[model samples]
Target: DDTPYDTQFCNWTVQSRFPSNQVTLGPWVNPTFLVGDFGLLRESFKNQEWGFQNWTTRRLQLTYNGLSWRDTAQVQFSMRRKAYWYTINIVIPSQIMWVMCYSSLYIRPDASPARVSLVVLSILTLITLSNRAFDMLPIVSEPVWITDYLFILNILCCAHLAQFILLHSALRAQDRRKKRKQQQQQQD
Candidate 1:
């Protein structure tokens, strides 16, 4: 599936076989003039989760076999997925998870259980959110904007976890050194 902001161009053409001279078909400037149920068409597009944009209409005369000329009317438009829905459901939640994941850095490294649990939980929740986002979208060969965003978040989470691990190891080593120094002082 393409990103919410990604637009798709579409064209609809109506051609009449009547000779241009005998009967003039259309230069339908208004969609309502072209289709009696223009509102219905708009609602149907909305139902399909697309927002219509950049609409234009053109009239042309086409000749076939160099003998007959026909009247043609064309409607051109662009469509995009409704972005507000994605912003509310996927983007906001993912951002919150990212914030929570990074916030683990503030926790004292000595409290390994709390710090590790916070980071791990954030990672798990982010993964769940990413999966939910993908489930809402149709499968496509290429990655979309949401996919890239989630991937970046995943990388950041891993980095934070690695930092915590290193910090915890260093603290433990320092504590061991302090204990050894105390024992040497007592023996002396």
Candidate 2:
């Protein structure tokens, strides 16, 4: 089955509509033997991550269309899956980037050029990294936790950047007023 990488492929049922004498299912899991070198990469499987959980098979009966004569058999299996690489690679890096952006607020607001440049670069980098992270995951209508975090962090960074710009403008005007007062005092 073509499933998303993050999905845990568990509890699959194989149903047969035809009348069955009996449905016997003995499902077993043959774990892939991985060497030390390849074990960490087990979850890197295409489409589905590595499923290490126990598999169970159970037989069940079903009725269809209110037909008393018709019988159905189903075999269900459960397996556990893991998706660690995406979290380690994409999630961690994005969080670190946000931390860096937050720390930029400590820069002196009087340094207008440096502060502006840093804010612009941080915004651009965050947006680019966020895009890359989203591209790694399948598109969905709801936003994931990481997506929400990134969006909120981006908003905070933008608000702080705007505040810094305003502070810088105010400081520049104050400095101009001070210079005018000093000049007037010297002439007097």
Candidate 3:
């Protein structure tokens, strides 16, 4: 029995005696998180109150404590958000941009096929890596994801390269034409 702010999460506890057929309990733990501006303290439980999520954290604690417990009931856990969460956010967005932009740019006729292929493949790899990294997303899988961000970034890079290549080729052709005219004039 848990009450709001008192027993609900403040003094967190769990019945973690999972049976063999069920998922193995990795030991009971208290969850702690650092958001952009706030540090959350939480405790996890397999036995939450009725109408609550089955396997979710109960409360968040703001302080850093060693992951130790006097009894088998709980272990104080800590992880750096900056070290993991924020870093992932940057990588995810970068991957999406790469894939979206490069997919189109790689198809340009004026761009070097070899370079285009390499860029596309490299970005695709990053997208895949990011996808795997975010395999345990809090939200449901959707069209937009960390992988998607990398994909779009690759595409953008390819587009920029293609534009530059196109410009270079056009200028080269123009120079050749000017030289031909000069030769013709000299012969005349």
The model with the greatest TM-score is 1
- Candidate 2: list runs displaced more than 4 Å: 1-11, 15-56, 64-83
Residue runs of model 3 more than 4 Å from their true location after superposition: 1-141
Best model number under lDDT:
1
What C-alpha lDDT values do all the predictions have? 0.76, 0.59, 0.45
| lDDT tens digits, residue span 1-188, model 2 | 22224435444444554665544333223336321211222233334455544333444566656663333333233343345765676667666766666676777766667777766777777787678768866777765766676687778779868888788778889999999999999999
Candidate 2 structure lDDT: 0.59
Candidate 3 per-residue lDDT, tens place, 1-188, comes to: 11111112232333323222222234333333321122222233222222222223332233224542222222233321222443455564565545554554445445566555656666566655556555634443355444455565656676666665776688689989999999999999
Residues 78-186 of candidate 1: C-alpha lDDT, one tens digit per residue: 9887788888888898888889888889987888898888889878888887898789877778878897898899889988999999998999999999999999999
Of 1 and 2, the candidate ahead on lDDT is 1
How well does candidate 1 match the true structure in TM-score terms? Answer: 0.79
Q: Candidate 3, which ten residues in sequence have the lowest lDDT sum?
A: 1-10
Q: What is the lDDT of residue 39 in candidate 2?
A: 22
- For model 1, how many clashes? 0
Total clashing pairs for each candidate: 0, 0, 32
